[model samples]
Target chain A: MAALVTVLDLSLGPLTGDNFVIYRSGLRWLVSDGHVCRAGEPIAFCNIGLRSSDGEIRSTAPFLREQTDFQLTLAAPMPGTLHQLPDASRGGWLDQLDRYQHWSESFIPGSLDITGGAGNQSRWRLIFSAGERMTELAEDRSGRLTGWRRIRRAWHGERSDHGTLASLGTCEQNGVFLGEQHDFSELLAASPGSLHVIHVGDENLVPAAAVLSDRMRRDAGANALLAADMTQAVLGGPVTPGPADWHYAGSALSALTRCPLSERYDLLSRQGLSPSVAVNAVVLSVNAEPKVILRHRKLGYRAYWHRFRVDTTGQAIRNWLNVSFEALSRTIDDIQTDLRELCKLLAERGVKHVLIMNALSTSGGESIFTYAPFSQALGDELPSVRMKELNLMLHDLAEETDIAIVDVDSIAAGLGAAAHLPDGVHQSGPMQDEVRGEILHILEQRDFFAPPRA
Target chain B: MLLELSLPLINPHMAHARVDSILVRPDKKIAIGQAILELTVDLSDQFPHDCPPVSYYRLCASEAAWLRHLAIAAGEKAAVGTLLATFSKTSDEAVENCASRALRTTVVGVTRQWQPW
Candidate 1:
């Protein structure tokens, strides 16, 4: 009988849900190809970034600005065979979309590794081992391997080839050897079948969803779906606005020292800046050109002041205010509607299990201020209020549809105000744990996973 | 007229709940939709076993009323429909009746007792 492969497709993008890039940049690969990793094991290290003191190749783009000097590491998303795709170094700037499409097409469903990274530094690595003996390895600064001697000895005790480097390298490829190579195919063949839990959310859901997908793969042998750059679809809003609508902010100190916006953009593009890397570059433009700044200031003051005056005087401002609100409402409604349609489509495709995460509220209750530049100019209360309304809509939809709602708000609220960063949206460890736990609970309730092998 | 607010059946499977905290106090005027009390529903027996047995829920007031009497104290578990509190139209009436229900109010298991209001 053919071995059943459980391929987990992770679709992550820059600015998808909550800012997963910060976590993604920090990830360090742990398990090799066809290696087993247990649930909650540190398969990869995330939330750590790369930094160089020599000021090597720092792009002036806002996102890559800070990355020029330092970087954070993100954790390994799941447990499976680590199948790393070709690094971005092999492709040029224009070839990225094509490269990504090819990677997705070539991906065999049920594999845990995901594709696409920011630049040459970022690449896809997957964990394919579901339920095998987890061999733990240690490494030093020079990328030398340690601790594999014991595992090798244990697997091939008294064998003539036990301590050989060639044998060690071979053992690393598939699974541990008890005189013969133990491939993951044997374990997978024993299972019933595979199911895919496609996560559709922004960056916040990325790391948590990845971990949850890993857990599901380890415990239930299901394929957790992920994608690169599905933010616009999941968020139901414009992710990359035109340069004209982009807002730029800077501290007085930064403004003084900052290079011109055009120069910075040129520097960034010259350095092979990706859309993911451009997220912050668009916002934190410290040295905006004088002309651009003056133009923006005039436009901002005129638009805001006029609107404020109109609002206070009980008159609509060119009916644009209502149009913006209608658009926002429509966007939120479309998010729900799109999710429902996605769920229905998945069900028709024989996917009975679906988990949808509701949009989480910012910690300080100020998501509006954070998104002011990209979104329409609305009062402080509107964004928060609309978020609550969207969450409520999700709850109602879950009850009516086959989809199960993951209460991200409750998880955020449970963690208290300090769990959130100053930005009020992005979360780290505690929040990730909460969201993961909630997803696991939901999956368990649905009986999504198969019974563990005795 | 006096109105009785019982421990509502937030979840159909919820058999018992512990009062996590009380947001409102006796003789305090609370508006409609204001949180009255926080309840930790005991979900140990529900599906997805091994999860946190208790889920927190904030029971809010559906109608505007003055909290008259506290029947169940914080950290106490009561069956569904247990009298949680009583409300009246006026604060004076609530304050006047607070003394009568003082003996019945048995406080237990109260932790992080906070009055943000």
Candidate 2:
């Protein structure tokens, strides 16, 4: 007696728009043929575009701003062995351009073979992702989320509305939020409900407390002043501005002008396009905090850039930074005050939950017996000492504010820092999974997915 | 008594570290908790992170000792077991061909602020 085999046909399900038709490129397979895929795991993706059905394009079409780099990834509806259809992909430029074919709802690009029996789901789940490129020339169609984008986002669910969570941290927080794929696959796979995640890169400007607060409170007049200052610095400065100098200056200005916390999103789902409120929760990294930051001398604005990143900038921009900004040293007390101000501003915007990932305090190499020889202000002189003190300050702040601290320090200590956290900032895969689990736990505890009150 | 300070395994992923700067000099008496040398551990090739995990650490003396001989200098790279320096219990003690043991020391993380203005 042979076992009963059930084959499920996966189709491009309903992705509706009011006055436009959906078009897509050839299939780009993520998994190989005959590979068993778990439910909710992305199996394939393709570039997508919208076309006006009546040849009358309106000012606002679906994903208008993100039309240049709009893409959709297909998630497995049920667990089974995947069998890709022969004509699904034509290879090369055919797979790159979205205008190659119309996205038919009845088209079956793949099938799944289940040994025993199949689950009820036969329709392929759609996960839409889009990236607003930092520069139009930064196009990378090689892989998923493969481009230099200033603002990249992805959303999934069947609900009419979605909850937004913006990740504004350094590489450490990016590893936890963006996952190993450099996409939101790990975070999205763990989340069964609806979520819209926005990730902003930290190459030009770090999202420290003082920096973010300054951005949030910056008015139009201040922005104009900043623009004038930057223009004058680049064009009138002593150093000659090259192409790289202009590029770096533009990116830095873009980072300084936009506030990720105040930006809303338009999410596409089964119910069509619906507006999501500004981020309900924000995840920050204490590692982004620096002992010293540069503040614009005349403008009275703060800019906290990593030393290595600043060193790599163009000579003109570096000269501009050197002449225009003054170094401001921040103590543990300064950091705490800046964080409290940020939380208060978030509260005014109706944002209640703020989760900060604490710094890894222990190095495992330190074997200090006494603190007699060290300076009285240990946090000011020692890096590990400063991190430990910063973590402590976060705890004190949490007592009064509506913020929760994610304990990366304790987790790293428990798992052995030498193996899991080699550089004290980045983590191994297992370590990231552990940190992700803690984040999910906190999100669940705070009922972050509950329906918004009217 | 002679003490030998070789590079310990400060980070598991590092094969070797580059000496960024030397804090103490030969024939100088270093007290406990005094910084000896600064080294950089870069795991950019060993690990798969978007940003290279390069860290700076300061090797400080845990036991008060007189610095006798310095083997490695600033800008030199050393392996895990490469001897960094030799120390003695007394400042005037001869350190020629003496049996030595591992020196008691602490590796503290440090930060370098770039001020190119």
Candidate 3:
């Protein structure tokens, strides 16, 4: 907007007097000749630019914006600092507002190593601690509100494996400022499957965020609907070395930064930026078993890397994996309690619907992850919340109250299991699409998001 | 009398611009004619080019009673399209807020006789 203002000024000359005020307020384009306010009715005062006094010509140009209920989510160079760009040639505020990417959620279940406490740290593999919260909510630092783009369908028709390394590396293709701690160059180097330069002690750039982005993109089957959206935060960068000193980020980085959507224009059509979407629900793990992501502890930067345990055991819990009967029952009981509390908290945040996504019942006896884990082995900790049984419980609950229940069981059962999940704890790549799809199906079939009629 | 207005810019079928209001007091009689006039004056300044100014003149009480007897001649003169509204009070707060911001009500409800355009 600032750049355009300058260009327009150079071309059109100084807007003398009230014309300046009109242009500055963005009302120069919308001034209407006259209007009527019948009696005492008050309406949202929009289109101030179209309003005109008497019957004189004010602005003779088309409006700067294609006025719709569209909300713009400005991503990057620090979304919070659009008004303060140090450089102007790359097109400052005007170019920034018309951003390339839309929304992103990066996750890093950083390495977990208990032996580090005892000093044998370098030898251990970094544990991929799961993210506990279902979703992390944030906005552009420059005080922009993020809104949902009422999408009728997912951008990709069929979920495809765009490659894990590729997705993680995409974020670094274009420079990004993670925060005050890490810059984009380091992040780029960390991605592309090599992070020898990044030590575990310097936990900023390399964390579970890279893994989460890969999982989400591959699992969700698309990079952010828009590229370079700040809504997402990265967990860990891939370990890819480069020539000389420049970073070598891979595919996921492209998926994160400005590759997928930038490469394809159709995906952006479904993307919309808004102030917010009413959601803060838990992504409970339906299965009691946990998936472990293997990560390397880039040693030498610090004494030892400590294990960070993300008990994604709670909010991020998903069903479909095989677990001890006790673990499954215990997890469900705990998750139910958490949901009860979430309902109270979410109500204050204006959430009306609470959806529970059903995990695929893939452990129908032959799954590898379920082989060692049958409830019969555990005497007392028997699992009660099995897949089919949980669906019935959810069905019964939905009938009893307004709490909406999304039956992911029937959908996933027909679609089969995802191949990427380790130990069958988390969802596999394409399976996530099937999962999100089935959930969306149930959501649409049922009145999960039916806005109240005014 | 309730005057139904249709604004074409809005959906024509849904053109009834509703001014939902809650009058706190109960059992108090409000002159409907005065209320309608107030509204017309309020919207007087809008749509100056397409929608012409309406009902610029008002009638005094003594003249109003006499005009009502002469059925052949007098009516509210504010030209809000074709329909001329009849009212008791010339102005209300709602009217003042919506009236032409530049036009000053120099004399309160002066009785002015004029031919309908």
Question: Highest TM-score, which number?
Answer: 2
Which candidate achieves the best lDDT against the true structure? Answer: 2
Model 1 misplaced stretches (Cα beyond 4 Å):
A1-126, A129-332, A362-381, B1-117
Report the lDDT tens digits of candidate 3 across residue range B8-71. 1111112122222221122223331221121113222333321221212121121111001110
Better of 1 and 3 by lDDT: 1
Tens-digit lDDT string for candidate 1 (A1-454):
6545555543321221121122122223445545564322333322212223332334532333322112111123444454433331232322211112221213222235323332322222221111101122222121111111112111110111111111111111122111122222211222232211111111111112112222222211111111111122223333333322121101111111221211111111111222321001010000000001010111111001111122222222213222222211134454455456545544543445555555444324121212222233221224344456666767777788876666656766776644442222334445644554555566556665444445
State the displacement of the C-alpha of residue A29, model 2, in Å, after optimal TM-score superposition: 1.8
Better of 1 and 3 by TM-score: 1
Give the least accurate 10-residue stretch of model 3 chain A, judged by summed lDDT.
A126-135
Question: The CA-based lDDT of model 3 is what?
Answer: 0.23
List-wise, what DockQ does each model earn? Answer: 0.03, 0.53, 0.00
Candidate 1 vs candidate 3: which has greater DockQ? 1
Q: Write the per-residue lDDT of candidate 2 for residues A355-404, one digit (tens) a residue.
A: 99999987665666766667657786677888989999999999998899
> Which candidate should be chosen as best, given DockQ against the real structure?
2
In candidate 1, how many Å is residue A66 off?
31
Q: Which stretches of candidate 2 lie above 4 Å from their native place?
A: A54-59, A115-119, A451-454, B18-25, B44-50, B74-76
Question: Tens digit of lDDT per residue, candidate 3, span A1-454?
Answer: 3322110000111111222122111101111122221211111111112112342333341121221211211111100111221221123333323232212212111112111132322111110000111112212212111121111011110111111111111111111112112212222222222111111111112222223223223322333432222112121112222321111122223323331111111111111111112232222223321112222222101110111111112111111011100111223333344345444544554444445544444332121212122223221222222444555555655564445554445544454533332222333434444444443444444444333334
Q: Positional deviation of B93 in candidate 2, in angstroms?
A: 2.9
